[model samples]
Target: MKDPMDLDTPLKPPPAPGSDSPATAAPEARRDRTAPEAQRTDAPKRRSILGRVLAWLVVLALIGGGVWWFAFRPAPEMAARGGPGGFRPGMPTASPVVTATVEKGDMPIRLNGLGTVSSLATVTVRPQVGGQLTQVAFTEGQAVQKGDFLAEVDPRPFQLAVEQAEAQLLRDQALLKNARLDLERYRLLVKQDSIAKQQRDTQESLVQQYEGTVKADQVAVENAKLNLSYTRITAPVSGRAGLRLVDPGNYVTVGEAGGLVVITQVQPISVLFTLPEDNIPAIMARLRDGAHLPVTAYDRTRDRVLATGTLTTVDNQIDVTTGTVKLRAQFDNADQSLFPNQFVNVQLLVDTLAGVPMVPVAAVQRGAPGTYVYVVNGEDSTASVRPVTLGASDGAKTVITKGVQPGETVVIQGADRLREGAKVAATDGAAQPAAPTPSSEGPRPQRRPQRNAS
Candidate 1:
């Protein structure tokens, strides 16, 4: 009755001899057994977590090393070789250049300016007397000489006026002759005591009056002749005729606004130009020395030479507004290359500097120091920077006052790519690249080819 439930439970194990009693040993053993089983079950899980953490740490370390290698790597060529004097070492490529020999010759000092082609004389052919324009004698744009017939007005009216003047003159001459005969008769009667002196004086006075009338008639005839001559308009100057202003059958007058045609003298033409006021003293000095300065006229592009001439005159005063003085140059424009009112470039050779060291203007270069040139050394095919003192320049050549010698070669073309003590491959002729000099930083980096994506 007391252990009907206890009979269903298992029996407890007996304790060892030296150990505590069975009741006490049973509880201790149970606790020890349960602790060991729990520890064994958790061991595998702790080891698995530790392994996972270590694997992640290894992956992170590999990624960091790869990033450093790719970003901080040096170029293959630079890493393979070292440079001298802290500059990268490589075979310097020789720059191709064109050279010119410094020469000892005359360099003309010239003053350049813009100019206008003008006629030595310009005339507007207009009718001197008013009448109907009856004829145009010259063709448009025709060359004409002075006094050449250009146009004609109607001459009928002028002819009639001339005839009337002639008739009047004849009438007055007849009257004068009759009066003179009567005066002669009266003088003879007075001398013979047949007529009074008063009567003779009256006849003499009548003759004088008639003579005066005849003289007046003569003046009228001359005037009428002059007017008739004016009916034929003539070119006042030798020149090329412009377009006709008044057509035939149009009534023209002396007071017309624009003349019949304009004529401009193109041959032996004059060029009107201006130079800075400061140049006046030099120009005047040369002029006083009896030097006939040479002037050259070029087309607008300044490439083609139109004519060569001599300086004719300088204006009296400098223009206050422009600070320039006007100059005139005369050219024998035989080819008619220069036209009236055309724009041109003028170069006046004021003086010549003889026995000066000169070089092509392209050889001169400006830098922080001043003017310089790249002089090619003959001993070694290399170029060196040479400082030079620049004097007068004639556009094509420049005078080098110092630091360069005659017969020495200087780089004219491809100087922009030069450095001090740079090797060069020079050509004898003028054909050379005009590219500018490379910068001083260094040679440009070589580009790398990209790989195709897989």
Candidate 2:
């Protein structure tokens, strides 16, 4: 008999569905069906265990990847190169910047103002006598000198009057001569007792009256000649002539409102400008000392120089509304660079501070520090904040009264990226190998520089 539990051998058919082996066959068939059920259950259990292991492996792999990324990943350079304040716990990076040296030079104190070119003299040419305009002696916009002929009026009428006066003078002279001869005869007859004394006196009186008539005629002739000379007109000043107001062949009068033409002096012109009343004292001081303040005139943009001049005079009173005073400067505009009523920019150089510590105006910075600058240290490639004492600036350079010394390196551009102590790379490459140490000075009020406006 085969062991009931150890059935390695194949089981026989359930006794061919017959009798005699009923109990054993039925138990074997039931055993076979139960075994298949047990096999199916075990298969599902094994598959479930495999699935759980795979899921855990995926979770572990994800966690390890996150750890590696957070702990050992490389950082980008952009994070450190943002600015002077951009940094992390890593190697330091240098910031690119532009630099200028604190130099010792003279800084001119100049005052700027709006100005206009003006003519020293403007005149209107008119006729002294009323008559028909026979000829126009000048072209429109022509330049003329003093006493240059400009126009002419009809002279025939005045000439006729002169001739008539001269003829009357000759006739009066003839009568005076005849009266003198008669008076001579009467005087001689009276002396010889050939005539009455009263008669001789009457003859002398007649001769005197005729002499007076001759003198009156002579005065009339001279007056008529003077009137004839006034027909021609001339320029009163050396200047450029304007358009013709009265054309030739038109009747003009001495009382004409428009006149014949306008003339304006151009060479050696003047510029009129206004300055704040506060500048009067300094300007007056210079003038009282017999010093001629130099003035420069530029175009509207203040880029090109138009002329150089000297301050001539100041207005008697200040304009109360604008709180400014008018000033006149005379320029030798030999090239005719200045025109009447032309707008320009004026710069009056009042004073110059010499041998002062100066730096580019761009190097000056203003912030909570009041006014400051960035001084670079080339030895260690670092920039430090410095509170500077500023004086007057000439728009291009500023004078350093204190807080900075000569022969020092200063950052002119790229200062916005700097801090108290920031590493820098001087693109200028002129940063001194031995830069001066930072000053221990504090911030102070910056002196308001020159006011450059009208």
lDDT, each prediction: 0.85, 0.86
Residue 55 of model 2, lDDT score = 100
TM-score of model number 1: 0.66
Question: lDDT per residue, candidate 2, 201-318, as tens digits?
Answer: 9988989999999999999999999889889888999999999998899999986789999999998899999989999998998899998899988877555689999999999999
Worst 10 residues of 1 by lDDT: 439-448
Model 2 ranges with Cα > 4 A deviation = 1-95, 170-218, 377-382, 429-454
Off by over 4 Å in 1: 1-101, 362-387, 404-454
**Residue-by-residue lDDT tens digits, candidate 1, 1-454:** 5685777778777775797985787999899989989999999999999999999999999999999987774322222134554654555656788998999998777788888898889887777899999899899899999988878889999899999999999999999999999988998998899989999999888999999999999999999999999998888888899998989999998867898998999989999998899989999999999999999887765656799999999999999998999999999999999999988888888898999999987899999758999999888788989999998875567899998999999998898777788888898644545545442211222222336782
The global Cα lDDT (0 to 1) of model 1 is 0.85
